[model samples]
Target: MTLSIDNLQQMEIEYIKMFSEVSEDEQTLTFNNSNIPDMYTHNFDLYKSDVGLLEYIESQINKVETKAKGFFRIETYHPISADLIEKLSVKPQICTYDFMGIETRNYINLIGNPECSVLSAESSRVLEDGITVDIAVNEEGMGLDFATRRIKGKAEVYKNPDKAIELFVCYSGDTPIGNIEYIPFNRVAKFEDFDILEDYQRRSFGTSVLKHLLEKAFDNNIEHAYLITDQADTAKEMYKKNGFEKVGEKTELLFLF
Candidate 1:
């Protein structure tokens, strides 16, 4: 079987639906009023070019972002269309990023050479009450101190919110070190919200987190594991070495409000 732009767009939809509040009809995906630093949490997904795209952008600019900035992912089969860019010049902009969508289905021999031993995250425990993520990082370095504490405080908020998301935190004993979030849409696992304690980097934490997460995916009979990463050399090398092959690319439009 082959992947389509629609399938990947829905996965993008699933990504937003997991966190903040969203309402979608046929053409536009609206993430209404989520004040999270995470881009996925507060953004819109335009299926294709249409008048509705302009309307949605205008509406979001006035009612939503004001002078903040308009950052969004516009999923397309190929690179973005020039027609789309011309339509988006209504506002001043900063830059755009095209993410290479990577995937791996049938498991191959595990890939990668780590300087340290590879270890798996603890296990699948509920994000609500059963298991808690308590990764301890330098309060100043990566700002994990704020994010970790905030999410931990809002742990039960998911129950009242709309979607189901799986969050797994890795530990180096009683102290938590790293974590990953997987949102499964139709059999594809979308992995993001990854963080390792500042002091724990380059020590196989990333390798271990991804290894265990994919192992869980395989165990659950998942067909595809999808990742959207920047085109940076280091980011590409790390995931490529971990068996994630560059499959498709996603492009986004950026405008400075």
Candidate 2:
């Protein structure tokens, strides 16, 4: 069965609902998780690109900002106009994510490196270590550090059994160097938080981890696997080479206060 953009969006909404308090109306969907105050969980998704709605969104988010110290994010399926963007009180950073998907059957025979292996992690501790190392390296180059809160929030989400999420840690000869999160719903799998430590990159460990996950999905009769990656990220190239294709795009406007 070919999954359409609508199917992918619905799947994302369902996944978000697993760990958030979700409320929706005609214009927008709001997700709130006070425990996990991360951008992914505490944000508003605008259904329409109407500039008129900005005032209300700003007011609502202002209330959230007063209570917590994190980003105020707005996501839209339709691109917001430049004029609408300029109306914001603070300069916002915009990002676009490619929604990529692939049929798991196509990669059933794909082979990964013999030295690298992926395993389901019962504890989030290993995954947290990998994420901290990755963030330290990336921040050194980018000159920004916000990993503490982000990592803590992710670890909290990973512990939620109700989400039915599996955390996979990639190991190279007993040394953990990477991790990924898998969520299965209705025979479809959503892959997230895929990361490879900076020192271990450029090797084939990333490909190995991906192939291991794809193979596992195929073995379980999963029809398709999808993931969201930043459009500017080079990792999307690797994903394309492994059979995933861009099915859609998610646009977001973010303000960090």
Candidate 3:
């Protein structure tokens, strides 16, 4: 299968549509997940950067803010122009996400730790231990207070049987050390929300979980697997080392009220 920027973008949109209430217009696609009011799950995704569409994006965001609490975000497939940036009332923190993909055929024999085991999570409730541990270890200051709301919101969408999503918890011995989400569509699989506890980092647990995900993809005859990571994140290097390559990038504009 040939990997292209268009294919990566479409795959991402399909993944979002799985759990989000998506509404499309000529200018943008609005994704609203009332279940999870997180910035990523709820946003206005512009098909292209156009100064004329700025007002419509702002109006939609305003509508979302009134119904859903917390921050609002806008994603652009193309880079925002100076005119669009300068017109915003509040200066937004712009973020760039690199879309990475790989042909699983090239890595069918990849290996990792034999002791690390990946198990499918039947429900989000079962992921609490791993989520709690991961948050407590990775986040600063914010602990269970943050985890509670996040888990509650995620639980709404995680358990939906209609979605092609699968949640997995990685265990080392009897301890839950990490977790990841897998979504496969039309022979293309997406891996997201991958995290390992601080104490579990540097060991082979993270790699083992990734290897397990790829092996699952291969078993299902999936030709490609992909993930999105912040441009500054170090994890992209690890992904590249395995089999993934940078295929494209998307820009996110975030506004906090």
Model 2 misplaced regions, further than 4 Å: 38-41, 44-70, 87-89, 123-149
lDDT of each: 0.55, 0.74, 0.74
Model 3, 65-112: lDDT tens digits are 543655667777776777887987656788899988888766655666
Best by TM-score: 3
Over 4 Å off, model 1: 33-40, 45-47, 50-78, 81-108, 111-154, 157-162
Clashes of each: 1, 0, 0
lDDT score of model 1?
0.55
Residue 51 C-alpha lDDT in model 3: 48
Regarding TM-score, does 1 or 3 come out ahead?
3
Clashing pairs in 2: none
For all predicted structures, in order, the TM-scores are 0.67, 0.82, 0.85
